[model samples]
Target: MVQQTDLAIAPRTAMGRAVKHLRQQGIIPANIYGHGQPSVAVQVDALAFDRLRRAKNTRNFLTLRMPDGPNQTALVRHVQSDAISGQTLHIDFFRVDLQERLAVKIPLKVTGESYAVKNLDGVLLHLLDALEVECKAEEMVEYIDVDISSLNEMDDIIHAKDIKLPANYTLATDPEEPVIKVSPPRAAALPEEEVQVAAPEAGTPEQTPIAGE
Candidate 1:
């Protein structure tokens, strides 16, 4: 279910310097590869591509509907950017096989504070930013959400084993991966004993101490 937006962009036809000019106008030249069909060169809105790339839900699973041909169910496989302006230079869209399981990295979304952090004043530490998974095209999720409301102790760590994964989705990452944990935050400055005292006890018995002695 692709949400329709006015973010339409015409495909790019020019190459070399011409393409560079198009990119300067906030348009990105790209290509779509699908279903044994020859890859087609397309132009995407530079702003639109940037927005879609950062979208929380469609960041991973997105299908592009071509005006001339059939809809391309695809994922962004690669992206190139301008060195100075940081604008997108090109993007690669890979056609998806609905029946095949694809392995992709999806971001990890954590919601709700752990009880340990709330009651014990501990900090919630996130270990994993994303996880790889094997899933069919339709079952591909943009992200994996881990709920931390169950954590109840200072050392409570929520590992991959504790994740409530979606149906038909299997973890392709290490099972023992630590996703989140609760630990006390470090003080900005060390306590008295934690700080290193002056070696040689300052001037103790040394040549004379500075005038401030």
Candidate 2:
């Protein structure tokens, strides 16, 4: 079962430019909408939200506890941040139905050392970083681990079709897609000293005579 994280939220009356005041007071304005439900404007503690975001997988379901309404199960859909200051500007929570299967992108974590890379001097290339998968909210995984230890020779590849999924999980990505590969080591540039210029043969016209001769 997917782990659940809880966050306390409250209804927000601020809108437009007025929402700036909420941020000034260390509150984050947010919206919750999904499953064909009307969007709800809400507010949450900035510090608390930051901690939750840094500590947990944002893709995991979040239990939003509201002061007046019933608790909501949501996914942290999006977060808008200031490009310069890196401050959280706004957040969007997508409410989910635990019983329904949903498609979400799960990060692909590369694990285990590749023997080709360690001993054969091969270069390991990570072609894909995430996989799109469909699974019930209750069965969603934090991330999928892709072991590269199977890569024992150059040109060895791990394709999406080779990935094993948990029960009830189905891949949304194309099976032919290459996820990772071990490539032959890059060719090293020749050193300047190794770049030979043929010298003129001893009696050739192209040879220059010695100054004293």
Number of the top-ranking candidate, with TM-score as the measure = 2
The TM-scores, one per candidate, come to 0.76, 0.86
Best by lDDT: 2
Residue 30 lDDT in candidate 1: 81
Q: What tens-digit string does per-residue lDDT give for candidate 1 at 57-95?
A: 335545676666566567778888769977677888787
Q: How much is 44 displaced in model 2, in angstroms?
A: 1.2
**Residue-wise C-alpha lDDT for candidate 2, range 28-136, written one tens digit per residue:** 9999999998999999999999898788656678999998889999999999999999889999999999999999998888888999999988888889999999999
- Give Cα distance to truth, residue 99, candidate 1, Å: 3.8
What lDDT would candidate 2 get against the real structure? 0.90
Give the TM-score comparing model 1 with the true structure, all chains together. 0.76
Runs of candidate 2 exceeding 4 Å displacement: 187-213
